[model samples]
Target: MKNMNIQVKGTIAPGYGVASGKGGDSRFPQGTIEMQKPFFQELGLDLSPYFSGTLNISIHPHRYRVKSFKYTFINVKWSSIQPAEDFSFADCRILFNDSSFEGLIYYPHPDTKPDHFQAADILEVIAPKIDGLKYGDELILECDRTQIDIVIVKKFWKY
Candidate 1:
């Protein structure tokens, strides 16, 4: 078999704070504190992409250890990812079946510990048309892990 061991690089946290706040996280690299709307706009806002799909949140542990979690997209399909007119994009999602993680990215945290995104990271996503989506977008993904057993300890990127 090939190398099943991999390292996680970065992550997209869901609930981030800007100085003072309870919830709201930027899908971009941490320390890049931002508001969702403007952030999405920068990525060419189009909520339609999340109609029925997955948005992957990858983790690169900077080379550490940890488990992961994820949301599954059951009824999603490439064709259903609507608004296929001006710009076509892709959807990505990731999850680790047995782990929880936290750490700093981009800008180091006071704790500055390289955690999360371990060798056991999970990834699943649809291909973007082109340009590799160098920006961000608002997306919602649905997942269900009620009928499967995944004991993974490595990173996997599925394009």
Candidate 2:
């Protein structure tokens, strides 16, 4: 069956910088993705094509939940100092300035992740490095409705 797709308007927002290790976190100096790539590769998912850092997108007044997923890696023991974590991914497309780029919805299951909590309205995306993208820029994000569900939590002037 063909997957249903949902598109929503989002804004590029800044994250805690923990994913790319720019937050000065001593434990993950090389970034979380860099540390986890080999483990994911071992599990048969090659994340080498995507950027090392995540693109934080905010769909304010709208929260999200993963109803299904394209890929899920369970109990990934990427760090020696930290506990194993589960991760899920869903196919996504980011459109900005009339350009579209393929990406993945990077979901680190909160039940396993120890720290760096993200808001319900924020989505962490991984894609090829796009030039000229900056914080506060508006973009359209498309995701598989079956994999990721987005809904308006509050009607705040119809954002």
Candidate 3:
């Protein structure tokens, strides 16, 4: 695949924190994990290699669109715990504070996601927990340009 690096700045924000939940007790993290299990397995990935929850980052001014040559949508089935949903992801490397981690930029289908998660400037990233990070802190996100398309909707805005 063609490779290029794209960088952007974002600030930490509070999220549903459902990925930190165990099993099907919680809605998002648990449900996402269960739903994505089959898809990952099909790709020869381990059943559960990601953190249970996600980190919310508000990317100011600019919004990103991902276009991958080899991309697929993940369909999450409805169960006793939650409703069915569809989402897409792009692999990325996140740089926060002084640490970096490999992660995925998760974009839930607009119609399928909760209202709170529909912000255009917000990004949901799944990665191992980063210590000493808290809400309102700024960080940098670098990803493969081939996998993501960025469009600056507004020139300046504060969060």
Candidate 4:
């Protein structure tokens, strides 16, 4: 069966500085994505067109689980000081103010990820540089249902 398209509203949120290396994260002085590019390129995935940093999008009340993936690189020893980690990507689109940009959902498996864990509501996106985009900006995120399953988490109130 063909994949279904799912659209959810999300807000851009600040992320851990390790992805861009702007923050003083000693583990990734050059940024995690920047250091991993060469390894990804060697694995036949060139991330040159996209920005080195990730866009942290928050979809509150909703969380996602990977049903499948478009690309998955296993045990990539990108950093000399850190152990190898696995990464996955899925086709995605970011829509804002009548403009839509193609991107990939960047998923670095937490099992192998050493530090900087993200909340379930945050979706890390890797796309070409987006101008005039800032934190707290509302955006529409589109993904394939077959590749990602978005679900709502109900809250319980204490009596």
Candidate 5:
């Protein structure tokens, strides 16, 4: 377990809305939760300790290394209630100003994801909800570099 500090700066933004039930696939949240249950269970992780939904951040011009790993693919089967889907996740520590939270970064299989989510600058972070944060706010996230196997994938553009 090699630990390296990774720092990311970005502005808060609204995502697909599926996590908050505002729009998109209505069953997405439930399906994601269900799909993640067993994986977390196997790790002896308690889901009850965290909040549901993700914090979307948009980073433009700025580039940060993306860490990768051998992740388990979660198959969310479609039932009479919802559509089928696949999801993947990686664990990381999120640094927000003076606060820090342990969380997962979810990556939905490309075939099953919305176009807007495929942006290189957009990141979906799931953690216990943080208060006093709003859209357009700048934030910094620090995590172990090995967790995501990150490498700089883009060049920084001047605004």
Candidate 6:
């Protein structure tokens, strides 16, 4: 067997909130940050063939391209929710669909690697507002996990 070293250069596609208000964005003392409140949504973890495993399978330096998968949530009147009525909600994050989202790149692939890593090549939306908003009714979404094809250079660094 050969050494499995998968170098995943992952990224998290930026996402926008879908809510009944006037969208999300805020200007702070420094600059600005987009704030969004989605009406609601339901997302399930699905990893089929072509890329299915325990996230610990052996591979040599692999990079995965992740796109922002969106799923429609609740549909309010768009007038009920106030733009800045202080819904007492948390915040979220944004990312790209390429080698941008640095937080989602799990090198060893397993959460239980021999060397505990503080970082991984995995993309995710942090602390999204998807709990007690008004998300309900029907839902529709399209998602996929494609392998990021890139040239790998295996050169000796030290003698």
Please tell me which predicted candidate would have the highest lDDT against the true structure: 4
Q: Give the better candidate number (3 or 5) by lDDT.
A: 3
RMSD, one per candidate, in order: 16.7, 3.3, 4.4, 1.9, 4.3, 17.7
Over the full model, what C-alpha lDDT does candidate 2 score relative to the true structure? 0.91
Q: Over the stretch 27-83, how does candidate 4's per-residue lDDT look in tens digits?
A: 888899999888989998889999998999999989998999999999999888988
Name the 10 consecutive residues with the lowest summed lDDT in model 5: 63-72
- What TM-score would you give candidate 2 relative to the actual structure? 0.93
Candidate 6 accuracy as lDDT: 0.23
User: TM-scores of all models?
Assistant: 0.19, 0.93, 0.75, 0.94, 0.71, 0.19
After superposing candidate 6, which stretches have Cα over 4 Å from the reference? Answer: 1-41, 44-53, 61-147, 156-159
lDDT of model 6, residue 136: 26
Which of candidates 1 and 4 is the stronger one according to TM-score? Answer: 4
Q: Where in model 4 is the C-alpha error above 4 Å?
A: 1-3, 157-159
Ten contiguous residues with the weakest lDDT in model 2: 150-159
After the best TM-score superposition of candidate 1, give how far the Cα of residue 107 lies from its true spot, in angstroms: 9.5
Kindly list the per-residue Cα lDDT of model 2 for residues 50-113, writing each as its tens digit: 9998999999878888898899999999999999999999989999889989899999999999
List, residue by residue over 1-159, the lDDT tens digit for candidate 3. Answer: 225878899888777554455434435544555566576566544436667567778887878886772344555663455456666677777787678788778766777755445477788877776888788999998778888866788557789
Question: What's model 5's lDDT at 99?
Answer: 86
Across residues 1-159, which tens digit of lDDT does each residue of candidate 6 receive? Answer: 112222333322222222111323322121111122222211221211111111121122432333322322222222322332211111112122221211111122232222223222222222223222132211111112232222344558896
lDDT of each: 0.27, 0.91, 0.69, 0.91, 0.63, 0.23
Instruction: Give the clash count for each candidate.
Output: 20, 0, 2, 0, 8, 17
lDDT of 2 at 79: 93
In candidate 6, how many Å is residue 5 off? 21
